[model samples]
Target: MAGKKEDEQQKQLEFEQDEVLTVLARSGDASAFNELVRRHRLKAFTWASRISKDPHLSEDIVQEALIRAFLNLNSLAHNHRFLGWFKSIVRNQALMKMRRGGLYRRELPATALQTASMHQASVQVDDINSIMDYLIARSSQAENDGTSKDPQVLLERREWYGIIRAFLRVLTPREKSIFESFFFQECSPQEIAQLFQISVGNVYKIISRSRQKVQEERLSFLIRAQIRQRREDGLLKQNVLDPVSLKESGGSLLTGTEQLYRFVKARHPQLSLSYVDGMLLGAFLLNIEKSSVDMSSTNMIDRNYLITNGMLNLGMRVRYVEAFDFEPPDPNLTTEGIALAQGSVDLGMPAMVWELIHSEFGLIYGYDDMKQQFYGLDTQSDEMVPYEQLGRLQTRSLFVLGFVGDHPISPSDSLWRWCQMISRHARGQDQTFSGFVNGLAAYDTWMDVIRQRAIEPLGHAYTINVLRQSRKHAMICLAELVSEWGEVKSESEINQTIFNLLNKAEEQYAIVHDRYVELALLFPVPSGGEPNEPANAARAIELIKHIKYAEQLGIEWIEQIAERLEEHASRAHVPAIVENPPRAYIM
Candidate 1:
């Protein structure tokens, strides 16, 4: 009788386990969902924790990942391979997060692990310790010897373990949240931003810069280690090289300094690549000081006055765009902003630098360089690098626009006119004029739209938002052109729409707030003139009614404008668009 009871108990336990797996395999089972999460929670947590180097974020990443997994379960048509599929999602999400943060680490492969064990015995004899030793020795020399074949290598990798672990103390809650999404939770930047209700660029900037901060800690560690070693070995006193002196005496590498053209072009060939030269010149021109800040007071009575009058010069475009509009803080032209944007170039900046060296290429490089100079000061020699010179040399190796896209152009009032003027010139020419301009235009648009769109930096945010919305519209329009099963025979309409949208995206905001903000900052008025809300909303309504108004206007409305004031009262309890004149007379 006792043996039979034991048998029944064993069967009952088996039944319960089977039920758990079955329910997990099926949808609609809340208990099973909870069980699945509970079971995999630690594994997910550990993965995110390792990546983010923050534990609270680890929890957040895991929690968010599980929620997303639950929401997106419908996409998982099969269950048998769920674990592998889910793991893939987690890995992708983590990588995406890291990509946004701009934190890159060399990918470690299983081969690295296998080799670690094979050389364990001999490696142990050599007294290998500290991850730095493993990383430094293996990192630069991974190709030839396959010296990674040692189990002890894993032990030595523990050095970075503490460094990552220490990241918990530094992050703010939001940053911690972002870090977890990147390092631990393994959700993509798009996933996380959508999860938290923010822009992808915002997500990218937060995550990328956060890792930079933590990596800075690692750099600090290296510096301190050097200092300590030097002290222990009887080097000079620390008193001679304090932090204040170090800062005052030297510029941060992260900051820019004028370098010899040969030094930059030769040693850091990747950076000095030809395409980078154009970008460098363009960036320098973009940041130069403007001649006149106040357009209201300045006489622009004629169209050609921009050129004929000192007010309407190409140099004016350079200074105006650089001063009030630039968000990257192109301080002294070669600011950190330029480096950050350029660092994003693919193939490489060297290649891009090479491309800018040409005249026939865009000649905008020559145009920009010749017109704008550092502080509007002229150089002793007009020492312009000719366009033809770039053709003979290998183009700088930047592959940014080659694969996914190209290097970004800084957009300001100048870029819009520049592209239009160039495009206009291309209208009836057999020359490669427009194509080159188009390429530059495309590059600049990418920079303005994609790069800045990510951060949606202060000055350009409104414009970026409008353009992004329009791009989304273009994408949706393209989707509409497709049938249920396939694509259109020709995507000409789609292409044209995208092209048109990009062109308009450049000027939409500048025109709307045209010469308004410029005046606001100029006179230091305690209370600014009437906001554009009443007038602009009225115009917006007119624009809407003139066409399929509601359908035409797609940008999300902001409540910050006080419900359009006078328009607010008119629409308060009613959704009607009745043209009430009293609403326009708010004063």
Candidate 2:
């Protein structure tokens, strides 16, 4: 009886390992997926070598196959059949590589090449309706009754659709309308907003919420299915619950500054430092500053802009995944958020997590399952906080960053996009808050508050620090741009003039930043000190005048640069639409 019990336990253990790993992997648990890869890599490699016959080529085939498998892991109908599905991918990739090589060889002869080209040209194309009908037929067969007769197969076919439909049924009427309008009608967010009598951003919010609901429902379904399967297989006895824990061994794949440094190094190893700085400039990661009466105490100007736009401006194709908004953070979203973070790190990409502590952004590089901790870079230092602790702090933002394989846009085009972003931002056109100003007008608004002696010492100090840091980084980025594009002798004179204006503005902003720094030191952020005297208020008003003058000068230069670029475009016979600066706040 004892020996039989041991045998039963062994079977249960094996079942648990397979089912749990697959389920977790499907749910984007990186560690579980890594384990699955480790167990299957040797077999996959062996299969590829047998098909390719060339060891070097087989290695490439296997790697590509694995990457494709991981990318399309969700498409796998049956978790138990993963090995077979993966093997098929390997075989197909290897066969396609061999066929391409063979085709190239066959094309060597002029007669063969001519005959092949003629044959390709003569191939008939199917009409859209015919192609659609064929696809529907194929999909219906697969869903209703494919070759498989297994119970799991039937469960997947019948229950998966049913689960999705059930979730759709749970949506409110408004949500359903938005969903249908966006997905079925293929309407733009702006169009949907008009139809619904809402803002475009609201349309996005509704869609995002709907997607989150569907994702949560799917996860619940998968977990339930796995539990049922385990019971049916007799691997789990009645009333027995499988132990679910997220713990794995291994240090971070990339740590500290290495995450940012390595990404740049991978692309331009020879000039790694320059590339790293460029990324920093592009990402606005280097523009660390403080702000008050803005959204937060300290603000990174780049934070207001999309990192995707910034990277694109730097000539990188980036897919932006806005996990969730940070306002009104919810603890219930932690599981999905953690999975997203881990998945990004598993891909050798650091996820930017917001509100790590003190409303700051951090790069999450690693997690410790046993400790239930996440390792990240905070503003002050590298931090390792309990997962639960971090979750409770209400971090609702995440970014998965990766480089594109190739630059698809020209440098000139990228520069134009960057200019547009800058112009829009500088004009307060993108401000999200009422009564709060942004761009050049923000300086005037801030001055008005200071002139009224209504700003708190702490708030003034914070704003000063933020402005100082923003200007410093702006100077760095502008100087880098000059070094990059100004050396082109063929650049139009007007374009050259714009670059000179940018440099001048950078210098002017630096002086303004320095003045703010001096003021901040005079009226530093209060740390439980006596209240500021009335005499200091008079001094503050005088300082505001100097700041206002410097800011106006900077804005003038920026406006001039914009006009110069527009003039150059006009002369070059290119249509240019330059927007006048938006009106500033009444001060």
lDDT of 1 by residue, 98-155 (tens): 4355233333222234444543321222111223223443443543566445555445
- Writing each residue's lDDT as its tens digit, candidate 2 over 15-51 gives 4565577777789876567667756665676565544
Q: What is the C-alpha RMSD of each candidate to the true structure, in Å?
A: 24.9, 24.0
Question: Which sections of candidate 1 miss by over 4 Å?
Answer: 1-105, 110-112, 117-217, 224-536, 539-587
Model 2 collision count:
1
Q: Using Cα atoms with residue i matched to residue i, what is each candidate's TM-score against the true structure?
A: 0.22, 0.45
User: Looking at model 2, which ten-residue stretch has the lowest summed lDDT?
Assistant: 240-249
True-vs-predicted CA distance for residue 224, candidate 2, Å: 11
Which regions of candidate 2 are displaced past 4 Å? 1-304, 319-348, 355-359, 366-409, 489-495, 525-532, 569-587
Number of the top lDDT candidate: 2
What's the lDDT for all of these models? 0.33, 0.51
Residue pairs whose backbone atoms clash in candidate 2:
290-466
